[model samples]
Target chain A: MMQMADRIKLKVLDPGLLTTVQDSGRWGYQAFGVSPGGVMDEYAAELTNLLVGNPPDAALLEITLKGPTLRFEEEGWVALGGADCGATLDGKPVPNWSAFYGRAGSTLILGFVREGCRAYLTCAGGFDVPLVMGSRSTYLRAKIGGFQGRPLQEGDVLEGINLVEARDEPGKIVESIRPERDSDLPLTQSSTITLPPSLIPRYGSPILLRVLLGPQEDMFEPEGVETFFNSPYRISHEADRMGYRLEGPKINHRGKADIVSDALAKGAIQVPGHGMPIVMMADHQTTGGYPKLGTVILADQYLLAQGKPGDEVLFFPCTEEEAIVAWKERRDHLSLVRAYVDRLWRKYA
Target chain B: MSVSENPSVRFLAMGEACVVVEFGNTIDPEVNERVHRLARCLQNLLSRPEATTYQGTFYRQEYRSWSEVARAGIRELVPTYRSLAVYFDPLEVKRQALEAQITQLLQEIDVPEPAGALEAEAGSQREKTFPRQGKTVIIPVCYGGEYGPDLAFVAQHTGLSEEEVVKIHTSRTYRVYMLGFLPGFPYLGGMDERIATPRLETPRTRIPAGSVGIAGTQTGFYPMESPGGWRIIGRTPIKAFDPFSDTPFLLFPGDFVQFKSIGEGEYRKIEESGGRP
Candidate 1:
């Protein structure tokens, strides 16, 4: 087996719609007006890391609707999760929620996403981006963190840490250091990971999300609340990383739909004077002035992030206890995935 | 506000992981004082290793058990004008139980109301007993030049001379209610009524950072280049936010602010010196 290099570089050939580096989230600085920006699909992003045997909070590339074309400069392992982007490695199809080996000069091309709005790509060692304020999530507005605090562009090079085991040599223990790729040397067999069928998320339309009625629920009329719960809202084209603007029945309010500006939490369904509901997302502003009817539960917020324009969404009101139970179940599922992945990697790798 | 020995604060669940504690409906300083106090208390309770050390008696038994879970569950406590939003992890604690415990904890802590608050009506103002404690930071500004693009518009809207407008603005000490909308952007309270100007009919595409502006009764400076409707009156040389700096923010919530007139030469000198203050 040929030794792999300590440092792996990824050269961007085509920067998709918007590919930003993200982790779990930037925490503890919201009080200072900094948003907890991170990957929109937490489940997908974390799953990608798990497939590559990376830490749960490891930094990964968040690819938007359109996908980027990247060329690997060194041998390493990588995994793709989230939206199905019809990925291909060196002209061969790459399946979602699975890890695959990449040799030097191999190109990874992610085409148009057919399912969700965003996808996540994780390298075994994670991206070598500096953490700002305890995270590598890119907050483009402030131009802070992740690859110069901006989206990936063509010609940009990203560094990755070496976090995988060294390739074995036949009947000998050679130096761990990896030699540069040369045309003269015979190539070694590359490793691959096949995820269980159950691990894959089913990307469906007309997603339903659970929500809990809120701090400003009293401001809305009973009919307004009814409309919010009963009707299906369509995601507007104006939606972005900050929030998803929805078009549906107008939510009537008892008074003006403005309040003294207050701190905002992710998933807040804020309705302005115009009555359209805007569900705050990963890159939402720290504070808001509009009255919120409810907040989508943490367990189901990832569904909202995965929705694309024209996607329909129905909100179901759930008790606080139900939300907590749902969140716990999701966490348990993640733990199960971690345990399963570890066993699989040990046996197969 | 007669201390009725009842927890007057209303706790509303924002979601499984977040809850908003509403102290009062309006933006009263007394209510804001209680909000901040509760935030600090909650932070202390969750950050401390032991909950038995808490002296509050209302939920003594609940605190002992809940604090253990809260020590690792609580993520953020954000204090607004009249409320506090507690963001926590649902994996560690149940929401209904945590809400009840939080209500008990708030009831135990005594909030000092304004003098004669009990007899005061909704519109009537009471004597402020809990005055906010903050430092008065003097910000230097260069008004009515290339830096202040909408200075004439503000003057025209207020129907006051340019010099009188500056005098009215610099005279009052405004309170920094909160930093939001943009990083380090202060939501200043207490602008002079005489100089109040309506927001522009159409917001400009770009307002440079540190451009002081007036919108209705509010006055604030832009912390970064953003689209805004506020009528620009002056420009400050102080860099309100710097991501790379040790203290990224120049001003924070509860800080007092005042403006001092400066010339272009002084503005240039301060900008060249890194615009620390």
Candidate 2:
């Protein structure tokens, strides 16, 4: 029998804004009544895990808005990414996105969030966590993951189940490269990490979300579809991990209801009975019964995640091939950034 | 095994990653049985490689491609009442070669018992396959009062007393339909329509975890406390999810869940006794 609790334990003296353990995502069991539970910021979570040399799907703490204070029982290397919640290490502000060494008895306080929503904290070898439906991310709605399928509270401890590491692995801990803290921060220091100049706002001054016609594209009249692409829409207050609601013109259907609870993907803009658009997010349902008007390109999801409720958004139509190409370009860009980071780790540290 | 060709089943491509195949439409025992069998066969094959399988209302396995990009092959086998159109690019796929292999390998499969085929509706099935975990847990839940804040309201909606509402809820067996909206929140099926009611018009920003509720004709349990509008009737002491447990999900799809009413004292006693859900 494995004595799991003894290895790595954390006393969560306080449960920051909203902290949950998450990985890339929960997969392969949605049909069996299991939810696709995982981290909201997949990019930051994966990057932090890779930085610490843990397997891609290893679990980490996802701090939402606020952060929790933890006391670790063992010495380990940890990294934080996404959202600049002012994380303090023994009363000192720690740099974001770099590895930090914490002593066994040291108390780590993560509290950095001014604009962005989520922050990911990854351990040296990844938090030795358990997997539910083959994922380590905590899905609170289902009450099935993290610490006991619940959020961390005062006095809750976490244990690490990683294999013992050699004192000398070829890995280098670089502490200089931090994710830009400014949601409004000017990208002056680094060129590669900065948003591409080509990604500048195109549809006038407001940020209009570009989308592709959905599978049920013919459900709406040509004019309705035209209005969908041309008109400006405001995001409604009802927004969360599931999907986002949009307030716009009441779109009329050409024929009968075009949707019958078929499958739904991230970024699918579906129109329910109320004739309003609902844009599905990262933690969206596998299927929906609403008529889909459009689907946002995968490339633009990052911007959507940063969008707060009541923000002004526009829907522009794009070709499916364009969406596919755009996704590839985004992936290629991510690779370049990772390579640059790899090189910088060796140059510094 | 000299099999000719699969009548209703074939490989399908989902975007750039998963290959999907279906059996029929409608949720009869036959379609479900075949979905389960086919998933096990493909999973046995997938295990030999590193392809990760995503079994939901469909079966999809994500592949690690060049440039570190991930793609999945989606296979949905839920038995809808009619034919399901699976859209994909046929030209991009190695359909001829893959079809040959699928046919040959399918010969090795035993159709299980009664679930032979979807009666050849020109090859169409809506049955999507979800993954099955090993452990089947029987969870104990405490109903009514503080545990379920809206229990009495649900009783009123159902035209029954709170005790009668509890009786009907705990009586019928339920199966997980899908997990969505939140982590570990199971949308279970098989609820009696007698207790069916619409969700609250206004959603609460904070619905406590383990709060079981009924909506329209569906019933489910809330695993975490969050914003929800479901007509909550009661709560359970057992936690459905724990990121720290060896197996984080307490309830798997297809596994049965029954509610057991306990007093306030029993609820705390269960919590104190370390009775995890």
Number of the predicted model whose DockQ against the real structure is largest = 1
Q: Model 2's lDDT to the true fold?
A: 0.59
Instruction: Please provide TM-scores, in order, for all candidate models, with all chains considered together.
Output: 0.87, 0.61
Worst 10 residues of 2 chain A by lDDT: A184-193
| Candidate 1 per-residue C-alpha lDDT over B1-277 given as tens digits, one digit per residue, 9 for 90 to 100 | 1122345676777777887777776776677767766665666666654435434224456667767767767888777787788888777666666677776666555534424545453112211211235568999999988987777877887798898899999999987776778878888888999988889899999998889999999999998888999999889999988877777788866677999989999999999999976
Q: lDDT per prediction?
A: 0.79, 0.59
Q: What is the TM-score of chain B in candidate 1?
A: 0.78
* Model 2 Cα lDDT, one tens digit per residue, B1-277: 1123566664432222223344543444445445545444444454434233322221232222210111133332221111122222223333344445445435534432223354332112211121232234555667776777777888787789988888888786665433445556665667888888899999888887777887888788777677878888877777776545665567643355666767778778877765584
- After aligning candidate 2 to the native by TM-score, how far in Å is the CA of B153 from where it should be? 14
Candidate 2 per-residue lDDT, tens place, A1-349, comes to: 2222224556788889778787767665444334455776566666666555455577888887688998877655577777667787778666666555565787888774755567778775556566655666666655665667778788887765544442222132322222323331112233222222342211122445667675556678888888788777776788777778888887777876544344565677788667788887766776666677767766666556555566677777765566667766766655655565555445433
> Comparing to the true complex, what docking class would candidate 1 get?
medium
Which parts of model 2 have CA positions greater than 4 angstroms off? A1-14, A68-76, A86-93, A102-112, A155-163, A166-210, A255-259, B1-277
> Against the true structure, candidate 1 has what lDDT?
0.79
TM-score (C-alpha, index-matched) for candidate 2: 0.61
TM-score leader: 1
